[model samples]
Target chain A: MSELLNTLMQDARVWQGHRHNKTTTPSESTGYQLLDNQLGGIGWPRGALSECLVDQPGIGEIHLLLPLMQRLTGTGKTVFWLNPPHTPYAPALAREGINLDQVVMIQTGDGGDFLWTLENCLRSPVTGLVMAWPGKLATRDIRRLQLASESGSNVCVLFRERRYTDQNSPAALRLELTPGDHQDLKINVIKRRGSWPGQRCSLAMAHRADLAFRETPQVVQGPWHQSRR
Target chain B: MLWLYLHFPHLLLDHIRRDRQDQRPLVIVEGTGQHVLQACPEARNRGVQTGMRLKTAVTLAPELGIVRAQPEQDARILEDQARWLYRYAAHITLVSPDGLLAEIGSLQKLYGGLPAVWQTVEQALDEHRLTAWAATGHTPLAARLIARAGKGECTGDRGHILRTLETMSLATAEFDAKTCTRLQRLGLNTLGEVFALPAPELARRLSPEILAHIQKIRGTRPDPQAPWQPPHSFRQQADFVQEIEHSQGLLFPLQRMLSELEDDLCWRQQDTDSLHLILQHRHEEDTRLRIRTSGPEHRADGFLNLIRLRLEQQPLRAPVVALVLSVKRFIGREAPAGQDLLGKSQDLNEAWHTLISRLQARLGDHALKRLSPQEDHRPERAWSASEVQSKHKPRLTNPEHLPRRPLWLLQGPQPLTEPPTAWFSGPERISGGWWDGERVHRDYYIAQLRSGQLAWVFRDVREGWFIHGWFG
Candidate 1:
């Protein structure tokens, strides 16, 4: 009877580990070398929501997302762009090897309707990633999206924040992007799951011709007070 | 064959001046409903010129009457004249509002050659209380020059035609001042002088353009002209001897025309999506009835059904004198591919045609619109109504950025009542347009709700929370 109990216990442990492995393990990195290195070599968690905050306009926020969009879509995955408050110039995205045709632009006015459409698109098998400009969504709405992402494996949800919101919201990753006076970008990893918290790194904006990340030896401290040392 | 050309100097102003007995010389203004374009010959003689300030014209000739030009009305009148002349010559080209070219080459024998045709055209114009000059030549350009200069008719040999052309002024040749001066310097004052020069020397000394003109007149080169080809689709028309008061009286002729049009479409392997029916009433403006299809189609029975349905729903606004049916949108039959054992291929042509016809019968042609996608990220400006010619499909990006989006977007941005909570998952911030005053600083969030729903929310520094999209 003891031996039978031991066997059953081992089986239960293995099943539990398998079930939680995806949520615990980081599937991919942000692919930024120095930033990834400082943040424990784990990439942005998939099947969860990530929020990016920008201090001002034209500060290389779009340039930063180009690689993430390209990586997801290069594998024949469809990216659904929910109501982007601002119109993105398509030709510029195309120059970065991101197919504008595969990117579907949706314009939903209210947060309630926008959330509903996001759920529907994520449920579909064809959708690989969903990007949206949900400015100050309610806590309940964020929770619902997180649950949906968890249910839909391999689906990534990216939300762009126009301003700072409640810092305590549940998200897999939270990043803040700020512009530097020199032709460089300031990125802060405010939150991450199963990784170091409040890691910050600075990198130069990639040139139009240069798509791959080039390692810059220069490293700067986090501008935000919340960032960890 | 003879061609007639008329230059009505300030025709609109002349008509206005004759009708209004104002002491001031009047000029008909042609502008965007707010300015003057030209003055009448009487006004010009009174020192009023084109592009003169309206106030200045008033100051120069305080008694000058001003009338706004109705170009649309003039064009309609001109079209009617061209249609009447269509009976004389099967091919008629309207060069301008007042000028027409008829391919009377084959009709010459029937009308006693160039001289008789010229007389007939002149008589036709005279009957309408209009004066015009007619000329005949082997080429259209030569004839146009002769008619423009108001020079008398020429016949017999090519040399006689060339001689008649020589008497025309340099302005009649439509040459710019530089070319005219060069021609004068070369001692080539007349058409005959320019025609006598060797082609090579004339090309070198003067511009090749002048040489080409001379060659065109001499018949050494072919005169290029774009002959007007009538639309392939059919339009139905009925001429009534007397005007009819009731809409019922118009239905009989309309039905006949519809049947004829239906037969014509089937014969051409085409379907129509819209029909334009014009009712010409005696001493009244023509009433136009436009029928539109819900989809692509062409069939007589279906078209008739749609027209009958529409007429049943809405009564005519005015008494009908005649009925005319014209198709504006035509869909060509698809080429047949080798079929399977059933000897049939899957095609939507017949189905779409039937569907369109039914829709057209119920709703007029203008009611239906096909939405085509445009290459813009702005939701409100993403699609437009389909035009007659199909446009190229928008180029889609290859590396897709899947952003949560809604299916239907409001035409304009709706005002939000309150700011949204900025609970977010993804740190994807997009900030742009610092150079332009219209700037956006937003930190977009892809948030998940407890109900297993995904929403795209953003936080604006100035404004609070707004939901931009939802993911399904």
Candidate 2:
């Protein structure tokens, strides 16, 4: 009777997935409370590709990631930036307490090199985070990056245009980043594993401070930015 | 010190004939394409002389194969031989275009005696099917002169060595024709007879250079030699007897070279980042490609995979006669602590290095760039692209302790005619560049812009507000 009860106990734990629908895999904090709450593991899925879609490029996208970037880079792990839209400002990264020397930038002139550099960075043990702005990768390539991430045990985050939301993706988690009211950063959870989606979060940056250096109102927006409200 | 000199009488013939299996009469001709520089035994037996014109050599031996002599090939082959001989002795020097000199004084204790070391060297030469005339002497010059005369005697006693050297013809002593004629006029027919004359009298007759040579031979003057160091650069080549048009045929020879390279790297405890492969084509320019790695690496399998991938990506344009693999950059290989107690990084670094190398090999150069800090106050000029490396121990210091700065700096500061919504801090004045001529005077501020981006904005005080960077 005791032996039969032991088998019943093992089976009982297996059914717990139905009630919680979750796992206890080791996690890294996303630094945003709302988004973390919505995630099954309560953080950005570690060792998986997180597809981040931005409706408009450079719309406080880096602001949303600074807290987590700060946490990872604080431990002296290298962060790889593959073909970023613009050169990463040293002062900005240094302010976040990231060791600037640890950051690596790979310039991919062609598509083959783009995928190869991304997969290589993802599979490296020293690479703590790999952020790439890729030009339309095929589904097979995305799957390859996913497999590479599992071995690398790193958070591979890909930034793409919001229009790609309709395209099929194999990323473990996907979100769209946009500007919210009051200059807040808005993030909409489009897809996530083992969880219901369509969750939204808005976080404020350090409040905008103005210096009385200019008198005209003809300031142009950056290329990553399309229009101002 | 006891020295061993190895003279390669027909090294040029031996080098080219290493590919031939049969006893075909062969000769290496001079650059002028007129006279024969060296000949094999078969050609020599057929009355083909070293100084004979090509026409006479052809007339003497109709079946003789002739290959033009290249000094570069000679030096390369000589150094290659030195690298092999270095295994037997620590001190080995390349006697350019012809031979090698090895100091076997210390090796006597290791090999037990002179005969054993001689046997070992002979066995190695025989294994490689090379012909060498070796002679031992008290000095390198003595050994070289004795070996060149083909009157080699294996002995350590000074008397026996000089006795054998004394009988060699004055002409065979390698003195110039004028020097020999002068020596003959003095009625000095033998080296022993010349040695019998007083040193001061001989010094008056011969050139200062010849005086030094004789002193070095008699062990009365210092004859220092620079020991040959195996070059950090690695180069190994193979000639495909048959022209190979297919890429797969290249892999076999490449694999052999890589295995030898791995053994070499293992011996040196170093790694290389780039491999240059040159495919020699007959009657065409050699096709050369530089195979770069994503990082420094020294593994045969990883390099072979990269080679295979590259070959597949870029097919051969023409049939290749030979393939040469070389590497000029090397870094020390740090020993890894294998199988840690946590089992977290069991050869993980090695695995990643192999992965990066393979990626670099496949995608080619410009596929990998690492960022390192540059010593510049200007944020735009504060960083440079560095190659990824294994000794990544946080090499760059941040500008954190200085005035508050942003995490992400723009490629170039964007012009903003309008002011920030609010200014939090900084009236920090930065002025410079009068010396280098790109003068700039700016009042920087930490401000929150209209778009809610906390930016590092600066006013030229004359040009207006510009959003220079962002604090994440």
Candidate 3:
């Protein structure tokens, strides 16, 4: 009975749903209340690699990470994107509150140079975050970048095609993004350091259209029919 | 009137062998002829001597490297040495072939004494491993003669200088052969023994040139020397004994040159923004790599790291025979970062600048950029990649309540086949580029498409609706 009282007192913090105080890393807030609550530190861990696996290229993948990127760049830290799949539309990035000046996009034709550049940017002391969408990579390549990002005040986010979801990753967080019901961005938390990883979050991405323009005009739809004829 | 002379008797050989990791048997010989001008200790151990025939030297040491001394290259290197010595003394003169002379009388108060200045220069030479013989004299001519004769010693008093000069033989004096033979016929052996004669008698025996030399050594004649001013830019090159096929092998020579450059920059308290490295190839045109830092940089290691990265990316196209490192864009450092009041610590801003510059070095100059908003309303022209540093927090006021825009603009607009199922916002009209050839007139809207994706679509006034971007 005395042992049970001591154990209960020691495990009181766990009873309150805050068991990870000692194991959780210090982090920057994720800016989303529900997601933050589910995370161990209530935010994204700093100085660790995170992976974002997506089903398609343009389903608001860049948007999911924009808030964190904006926070870092706003503090005069640079964010480097290595061999991005699409042209980094500067105007769109600026609209997301990212300082257009702080986004450094690196283009490399060779795979080796791409990895070397990613590692260098990750190890930089002034780097806020490093984002690379190198289509597919061996687990060791991601581990090398993870090691480089560990010693600095940086976060490395890797975006990969969704087919790579089965391979194990060394990233601190692995989020799988896909289009959900009603066009919401569905985020499946595949891996979260120091916490349980099976939770899904959906964020409403865009303003709903008004009733006036909801219907497709008969004349505007004629181009496809005309081409078919 | 104190003067210091630095004589580089083995300047060519030293330049050849200084940065080499292997201390092999090597010597510099006359370009046109086969006579050895200088030999390293390894060559000397093998019975190689100065003025020995190159063929005989080769027989003595089978692996001996015979480097032909190029006069023009030697003179330029001599001037380059003078450029660094200028950092120590304001008045510097080039003693051609392989020596430098600088007036150090005025520098005594600044450097504390002659010994301090001597130690400083000696430390620099030892650091670079350049072979030099230094001497101090009341006149430049006396110092040059003593240094050439290898009897370099600092004499504080005039009596001591005179006594030292008296010991210098007439054979070591720089007089012409005709005057030296005539002087020997007169039984004159040392400078003191020859100049002790009456002026009229000495004039009768020796030519006017020899008389002028004696007077100059004795500090009686007016000896004018043209002070050499350093060039506006710095360029230092080193040739390898063997052609270097690997870029990593060039770092040693580059190290010595860059640190010397760092010392030069420290003396002037300025910094350079870029380095122009030219690799001299054996069979191709010279390969040039221009390394630009994000801001002014003065550290040798900082410059070297960048070069290593670039060299790793682009290997030598052909075997490189030599390398020339030059820097012309000097940025005068402003009020340097200060230590805190309590004790010296690395300043944050300074550290960031170093980090940024180092990043710029490894990555090309274009790798790092800060954005500044442009006034143009065109979506493509709304921002510019400003190469300048954003050292401080941005002051750009991004006001709230502006019309929302997409975060991903397509490389080019994709035509929208059908109208959106739902329209959330905007009939925002955008019309411009009437002056330019590609005029655009459209009313843009943020609309939810049938695919449930919010797309940035615009209707051209004349044409149809097109999807411009994606709102994430």
User: What CA root-mean-square deviation does each model show from the true structure?
Assistant: 22.6, 8.8, 4.6
Instruction: Give each prediction's DockQ, rounded to 2 decimals.
Output: 0.02, 0.26, 0.29
Best prediction by TM-score: 3
**What's the lDDT for all of these models?**
0.58, 0.76, 0.76
CA displacement after TM-score superposition, residue B386 of candidate 3 (Å): 4.8
Give the TM-score of each candidate: 0.33, 0.65, 0.87
- The regions of model 2 sitting more than 4 angstroms off are A1-20, A24-26, A207-229, B1-10, B13-66, B90-108, B112-408, B413-472
CA displacement after TM-score superposition, residue B92 of candidate 3 (Å): 2.5
**Chain A TM-score for model 3, please?**
0.80
Per-residue accuracy of model 2 over B292-371 as CA lDDT, tens digit each: 76566788887888889889878999999888999888888755556687765745555556766665566555556666
- lDDT per residue for candidate 3 within B338-391, as digits (tens), equals 657753333545556666665565556665555545555666665566554546
What is the C-alpha lDDT profile of model 3 across A1-229, one tens digit per residue? 9998788878845454555445657577766666676665456677788888875544666766777898988886778877776556665566567776667766665677678777767766667877888876999988887788787767778888788888888888888888754556788889987667888888754332222333332223322223411
lDDT for model 3, on a 0 to 1 scale? Answer: 0.76
What TM-score results for chain B in every one of the models? 0.43, 0.66, 0.90
Give a tens-digit lDDT track for model 1, residues B65-167. 6666566646544554565566577776777655667776777788887678767877866654454566666677887787777764645455676778877
